[model samples]
Every structure is written in structure tokens, then in C-alpha cells.
Target: MDLSDTQHRLLAYLREHIARHGYPPSQMEIARAFGFRQNRSARHHLEVLAQAGLIELATGRARGIRLTGPGTAGTPGDGLLQVPLLGRVAAGQPIGSDPEVRRELTLDPSLFRLRPDYLLEVEGDSMILDAILPGDLIGVHRTPQARHGQTVVARIEGELTVKRLDTGGAEGNGGHLRLLPRNPAYAPIEIDARIVDFAIEGLFAGLVRPG
Candidate 1:
């Protein structure tokens, strides 16, 4: 139960995947989820988790990973809800309505300023200045609208990405709204509603960092 941060995440992901889809992710899927280039990386992690009593891997089966029911910690309570952990939101499109739920996170709604509809495992450092890191979990409140300057999950063209909402271009830039990144290392993304598909997926509600 004394899991490393990565191991803890793996366990959480295993539980979440099963909860959402009634199946655990394959080793390859886990590797891909965590950005590991090789299946061996995930295999090693799974072995570690198994030895720790967090999961049981059935031999000879493809998707045989099973949760052993709260090993390192006690059972979760009613105060927690399993929030879907979404995969990468590409910059060119909105995420599909049935986009795969990579995992589920058990969280308390009261921990955040607003209740979150889901949790997104961010993949890039575009929002580093805002303390949103590559592996950090950002809680999202499902909504189609956001106030100017608020952080939001949006889809442009067909891809999805997170950025600060900027609705100030009613006259200039051909009324093209912009998705601004907090870090100066990245430039703002301009969205011309006339030329590309665009929609707001959610508003930033809270954040959970990996420990």
C-alpha cells in the first residue's frame, strides 16, 4: 500500500477503467495512457501493483486485470463520486460525446469551488504557469459557456484542448475568439467560428495533483 506516485495512479486508473466500462485497460493501454513507449514499462508497474495487493492479474487472459478491493487504503465513502478521467483533447476537434473514459477518480464535490462533471488528465505544459502540469488532474464542470478570461475545456475544428477563454474579438480579427495559454512559451490559439467548428466542453472547477 506504500505506493509510489506512479503506482498509485496506475491503481486508480485500473479501478476507474473497470468502473466506467466494466473492463480494465490492457498493459499496452496503460503504457499509452502514462506515455510509456514500451509495454514493458506498464508490465513492470502492473507486477508491482500486484505484489502490493492492489490488483490481481490473471494469466493467459488478455484483459485480466482485476481490482482486489482497496488494499493500501480503506474503502471509499458516500462523500466521494467517481469522476471520469478523460484522455487527450486534441487541438483540432471537439472530443466525441462517447469519448473513451480512461479512468475514474473518486473525489469529493465539496473539495472544489463547483461540482465537476469529470476529471481530465492533462497532457501538456501549456498551462504550466497556472500550475496545471502534464500529469495533473483538472476537474471540469460540464458546460457549454464560459465567461471571458475563465479557464475552459474547448474543442476547435474537431480537436480538443484547454485554454483560457477570450471572447473579446467581436469586431477585430473577424470576430475570431482566442484560446490563450498561461505560459508565454505557447502562443494563443485563435478560433474563427466562421471557418472552423468550435464548442465549449466544460469550465474549470478544480484541480487534483498526483502525489
Candidate 2:
């Protein structure tokens, strides 16, 4: 299905907006961007695009727009991956878990050394020395097991954290497993499997720093 000029511009705006902010623009924002008098106009155009298979829309969510076309941000056949942007994870300390899918991101597989199943927003500066800073989206390769000295997304008592894994036991330490922070100010998070419910969520593949 061929798109009208106005539809093409609107689709471009949606792509640029998602590329810049990691999410789609709201209906009001779209209406304003395209000089529409009402958000209904924006919705109408979006529905047209959806019918063309260029995008997908979810009901009742402010940022529910998703690009799924070939050679676009989402979908395959153009060397891209539609990686889901899961909720935030702590880089300093384990924070409350929120694994909800905020949105899907169109990313190049070459960006990460290892392809990631999903992306997690970093929330703290604990991993600064390793170049994983706050607000950076870290790629996570989903795995139940990670090797020693690998950076991992770990879960402790239901909370999530990003840190380097240390399985070698330290003398007199409570347990052989611990999560190490790159910054010197923070101490190692020693994991005692006997007491704390611990699990390796995934290995850190790479990262994307938002501009």
C-alpha cells in the first residue's frame, strides 16, 4: 500500500521520535508536531499507517506506537532487532523489580559484542568505572548462568542489580558468590545462597548511551 506524502512525513516523525527518546510520541505530541487541530486527526493517520503494516498501535497507553516494518527500526530483514526496553535496573544497589515492557527498541545487532534479548535502563553510577553510567541502556543476553568476572544482571530477593560477578570465595566471607561494583566507594554485595534468594538474570552484552 502506497502512503500519501502526509502519511510519509508522519511516519518519519514517529521513527525519529522513537530513535531519539527510545519511545514513541503521544497522540497530543503527534497532533502538535503535524499541526493537527485535534488528536483525532493524528489517530486517523496512525490508523492508516497501521492498516499499511508500517506500525502497530496499542490501546489505552500514552506511548503505544510500535514500528514493525522491514528496513525500519523494528522487525528483521534489515539487520536490526526489535529489542524490548524492560524497566530499570540498579547499578549501585538492588532496587525494586519492575520488569514491565515499557516499549520496543529498533537496534543494530552489531552495536553489542553479544546479541541481547532485551535492554535495561541503568539507574545508578555504581558501574561508572566500567563505563556503564546512569541513564545508559545496557544490553542483556538472557541466561540463567554467567561465568566468573562477567558483568551480569542479577536478582537478589526479587530486586534487580547490574554488577560484575565474582564466584571465587574470599577468606572468612559469608559466601563464595558476590556482586562487584566498578567504583571503589561501593562495597561488594556478598551473596549467601543459603539465606538470600539469588539468581543470575543475564550477562551484560553491551550498552547504548542515549544522547
Candidate 3:
């Protein structure tokens, strides 16, 4: 379809939302995201998309939108990646990692700067300053090592947490390693490998915000 720039953006957002959340965004959510004064504006855009055969909408449903055009089925041939949603991890203090696979999210590779091996639901606001907020689904690239200043998914004493890696500490000399938080309200986590088990599970790839 010959979509306008705003229509194209709205379509992309709809695809991303459905891929990330397993459902389309509500009209109110769309209105807020697009800065529309009323939900009617969002509805108008959706109706245009629906008329173009890009999406199918159901009446009497809060999140009734569905993708229907070419490359919208989220298949491998459509250039979509199926990344597993592997439970929750803490963005505040270290929390027990839930290794269970909740569901698979079909996402566009362009959403992340780096390709992610899996997705994790964050559960704290410690990384808010870094734009990783509570309930955000963060993309994690599986890796045993990460460079300094890079955000990493680390395990300390079997619990997982997301933080910026600071190897500048005595860690280079086999001492304590630091997991720095973006928010100053929370203190950085110091890992004493001699006392607690510490390992870098993966590097932070990118994230998909909840709609």
C-alpha cells in the first residue's frame, strides 16, 4: 500500500507490538504513543490500515488488531526472528533467574542493535537511568564475556541481574568485580568471586518496551 509516513510508522509499531506482546495495542495505547488527543485519531489510522488490507480488526475487543499483509505472518521466510522469552531477571537487586521458556516472540532483527539469543522480562527500576525499566523485555545476546561499560546479564551466587559491567575494580587482578547500576539510588553490586560464584551469562543486546 502507498502508506503515508505516519501510517507506515503506525503499521510498524503494530507489528512490533503484536510480536512482543502476543496481542495488538489498544486504541488508547496507540493514541498515547502517537500523541493523539483522542482515541478516535488512533481508530482512524487503524481503519485506514484495515482498508488497505494490512490488518484485520475485530469489533468489541480491546486489542482486536491483527496483521494480514505480506511479510506480516512472522515466519522465518518473512525475515522475522523467533526469540525465546526466558522468564524474568532483575533490573534492581539480583533475583533468582527463572530459566523456564515462557513463550517465543517473533521480532524484526532491526529492533535490536545486536541479535539476541533470548528475551527476559525485567523486574526492577535500578536500570531506569539506562532506559531499562521495570517490566521491560530486554534482549540478551548469549555470551560468557562482555567488554567493560557494556550492560550484561550476570549471575552472582546463582541469582541473575542486569547491570553495566565495571571490570576496573580489582577483578582484573582476580579480586572483586562490580556490577554498576544506572540509578544512583541503588548501590552497585560487588562480586567477590572468592566467596560467591560469579559469571557473565550474556551481554545486553537491546530491549522491547511493553505497550
Best by lDDT: 2
Per-residue lDDT of model 3, residues 1-211, tens digit only: 6778889999999877777664467899999999999999999999999999988877886766777777684545445566788999998889998999986665666667788999999998999999999988899999887778999999988999999988875544266778999998999887776678888899998898766
The lDDT values for all models are: 0.72, 0.85, 0.84
Ranking by TM-score: 2, 3, 1
Candidate 1 runs further than 4 Å off: 1-78, 90-98, 169-174
Worst 10 residues of 3 by lDDT: 73-82
Query: TM-scores, in order shown?
Result: 0.58, 0.71, 0.67
The local lDDT score (0 to 100) that residue 118 gets in candidate 3 is 96
Tell me the lDDT of model 1 at 115: 81
lDDT of 3 at 191: 76
| Ranked candidates, highest lDDT first | 2, 3, 1
Off by over 4 Å in 3: 1-78, 169-173
Give one digit per residue, the lDDT tens place, for model 1 in 1-211: 5778999898888766655443467888899999999998998999998898767777765666766655422234433445777666532223443368876655544446778888776777788787777777778899887778899898766667888889874553246798888788788887886677788888888777655
